[model samples]
Target chain A: MAKLDASGFLIDLDGTVFRGQELIDGAAEAIHTLQSLGKSVVFLSNRGNLSRAMCRKKLLGAGIRTDERSIVLSSSVTASFLKKHYPLSKVWVLGEKGLTDELALAGVAMAQKPQAADWLVISLHETVTYEDLNLAFKAASSGARIIATNRDRSFPNEGGHAMDVAGMIGAIEASAGAKTELVIGKPSWLMAEAACKALGLPPGECAIIGDSLESDIAMGRLYGMKSVLVLTGSAKLGEPRLYEPDIVLGSIKDLTELAKEGILL
Target chain B: MAKLDASGFLIDLDGTVFRGQELIDGAAEAIHTLQSLGKSVVFLSNRGNLSRAMCRKKLLGAGIRTDERSIVLSSSVTASFLKKHYPLSKVWVLGEKGLTDELALAGVAMAQKPQAADWLVISLHETVTYEDLNLAFKAASSGARIIATNRDRSFPNEGGHAMDVAGMIGAIEASAGAKTELVIGKPSWLMAEAACKALGLPPGECAIIGDSLESDIAMGRLYGMKSVLVLTGSAKLGEPRLYEPDIVLGSIKDLTELAKEGILL
Candidate 1:
């Protein structure tokens, strides 16, 4: 492949930059190199369990210097979408602290009872109860608009895999007999738009580098941005090219090679 | 439309005999009347949250005289199925105390880790956590056989509807990329066989009377039993007759009227 140039970098966190608590080799240096080259970089994450500040702290702990403002989370995108579309609406949330914090910061009123809510926001949580499911079902049956952060069923954890938000979303959909009206995460235009806004650049000038073809690469292609797939994550090289990425590299370390070859400007 | 005759009675508990704490009108009297006529009756329940003892206690509290031997619960059916099919298997349970207690009684070895389980038994509980979901997903991905007590999405409670085992099942199926291998509850032949064994009668000689056509009537039809639908619960008069019941009544109180009309043989 010839040298490819980009003005803004949209990077994934869990698989590309690190896995669990350990940092991927050359990830921090690659981000620093891009920054030295005067490229605007935003860390994009589909995880809704942690707040942007917590995400930034984790990135910093792994030797990457990024602020909360430079972290684009699906929770933030969802909050922004709710604020713009359903202003001052009573909302019921089924997520962790990260998602709830974002909505509160957006000044959206939280509904104590599910039936009282005009909207329902669903995400992943570590302690979901049957009562929560009943509440969500009741709210949805009463005509509450349903929205989800993402639909990734399982994510790689310290163990083989852990249940993600998609599992919870599927359960709610099955019980409520309603589908999600909006999904503000990777593979959706909403996440891409949010990242572009953070970078202060147009979609044409931005490139997204991540591991999963279904989410990261699909999102990039949906918004007409360069998509780079790294192999240090969920996807493998020999897998079917369902969502053909713009470029496939062995790891994020190849970003340094792309820089050395004058591919990344 | 004339009073129907049957040998044994297969009755549902929640909707037909009682609704929550209040017993349905004439339900106890109808059962007593059937007993007085020397007819065998078995109470069938899809609820897995309570053990047979607890179920019997609840029935007795509601002015009915039924022993544990005459009650057939989904949990007991599941336990029996597991003991017969996956003998001495290391089972992991995701259910309430009733299901776990039944499995323990069956002497099936319990697995603490998901990967260590040879079988996964899923049921409903009020306090399911995300960690439980992750373990179930991991076990299922590692080839653990999945079984459920029932697949009812919701049950009618005092507050409209409460989420049931189907929601949890759907969530695990979505995350694990696998479906349940066996569901030993309503609409399954397993429950019918258990009920028939309890009554010492064949399916053809028994009649099932309940409110929901989807469950009680469907099971009866599946096993060639006489299906009766009562309109005191979920189903209405003019809805789509997906599974037509042999007879329909306004409530279970009409069973006495059927006896008065010389239908009880």
Candidate 2:
């Protein structure tokens, strides 16, 4: 079999670079080496809670220098999708500031009342109130199309796995008697498009590297990109695999050696 | 096939007797007449928000004279289930006062922290806060057994269909990455058993009356009771049926005529 040759990489954030404020081992050095070789590397996250600027700051805090332009988030992808497809629609949001801020930055119309909504966007809000859930339900049942940020059920947190947007989506869709019309993150074509757009590379020329098999590896397989599974996060060795990756690494730290081997050329 | 000769009746509330604040026509007369015939009539409701006392008050306002003994609610059923099975288990709740009140009334242990809980009970809470959801997520993820009050996605309200316990259940299950282990209400055998126990009659001698096909009618079919569907609720004639009832009535008002024809006798 031929070895993978990629000009750019779409990297996951949580479970890839850092988890719960703790940076992964060799993460900064690997990214530095990849950048030193002039290989395009774009960090991708399905988190609607972190805007690109916020993610950039966090990466910088971890000694990884990446501009906001190099970070692509689910919020950003959703914003762009809404801006292009639902430009005139009044969007109601059940989300945190990062998602709402991105939508506003993209010139999407925001609706304060459920009755005024043409679209209802869902994301995770750990502090979401019952009244807020009702509003989302009302907007959705009243004919607003639902757009979800991601399908992640939970993510590893300091305590354990914290509920993600999938919970919110599950609740709203059940109440609204409808399913989400679109999703803007991993495994969705929309997010794949957004990441490739940020890297300015074709799908075949890029590799998606992350710790999740169902999400990261699935996204790569669905979009014709080489997939690299790392073990720094959620996935473990010898676990039952639902999605297989083209390559496996102990962690993102191993990328430096792969770069030295001309894989990043 | 032999005709139904029920000695007792299991009646639903919301859609069967009333909607929002408006009492359905003849609901009071129907119950009064059934009681006059010396036949047992137990009001069965999947609502975890209402206790038997609260339901009695509401029915009183509707001109129906029924004691708490004649009412069987999901909360009451859940409390009984917990008291019998998990008597020593500390329970945490993502629910309203009705559910907690019933649990407390039944002497079910209550825990305030996720770590301290052995069971997590879920019910509808219109005013539940986000922190509460996280607590539920925490408890469920930490291996607390999930017990849901009902699976109702929505119910008829003043404006339209309102989101119900299903939303809460959906959110928690997705977040916790587990399905609910038990449901204490309609379509669950537990509720059927509760209703029949309240009436002090065998299932074959009782008829279940309500407007929902999936819940009420399905419950009757699952248990050994006769089922009656009424038109004064969310269901409509000619709709594709997922469950088939034994009989159909225009409304509860028609019960009086059915009573006159020896059906209630």
Best-matching candidate per TM-score? 1
RMSD (Cα, Å) of candidate 1? 2.5
lDDT of 1 by residue, B21-125 (tens): 889999998898898888899999898877898888898888888888899999999888888888879988888899888888877789878898998898987
Worst 10 residues of 2 chain A by lDDT: A1-10
Give the range where candidate 2 chain B is weakest over 10 consecutive residues by summed lDDT: B1-10
Cand. 1 TM to true fold: 0.92
Model 2, range B1-265, lDDT digits (tens) per residue? 2255789999999889988778988899988888888888899999998778888899999898888888889999999999998889899999988888889999999987887899999999888887788788889888999998888888777666678998998888876787888988888898998888889999999999999998899999989799999988878999998888988899988889887776654
**Residue-wise lDDT of candidate 1 within A48-79, one digit each (tens)?**
77789889889889888987778989898888
What is the alpha-carbon lDDT for the whole of candidate 2?
A: 0.87
Angstrom error of the Cα, residue B43, model 1: value is 1.0
Worst 10 residues of 1 chain A by lDDT: A125-134
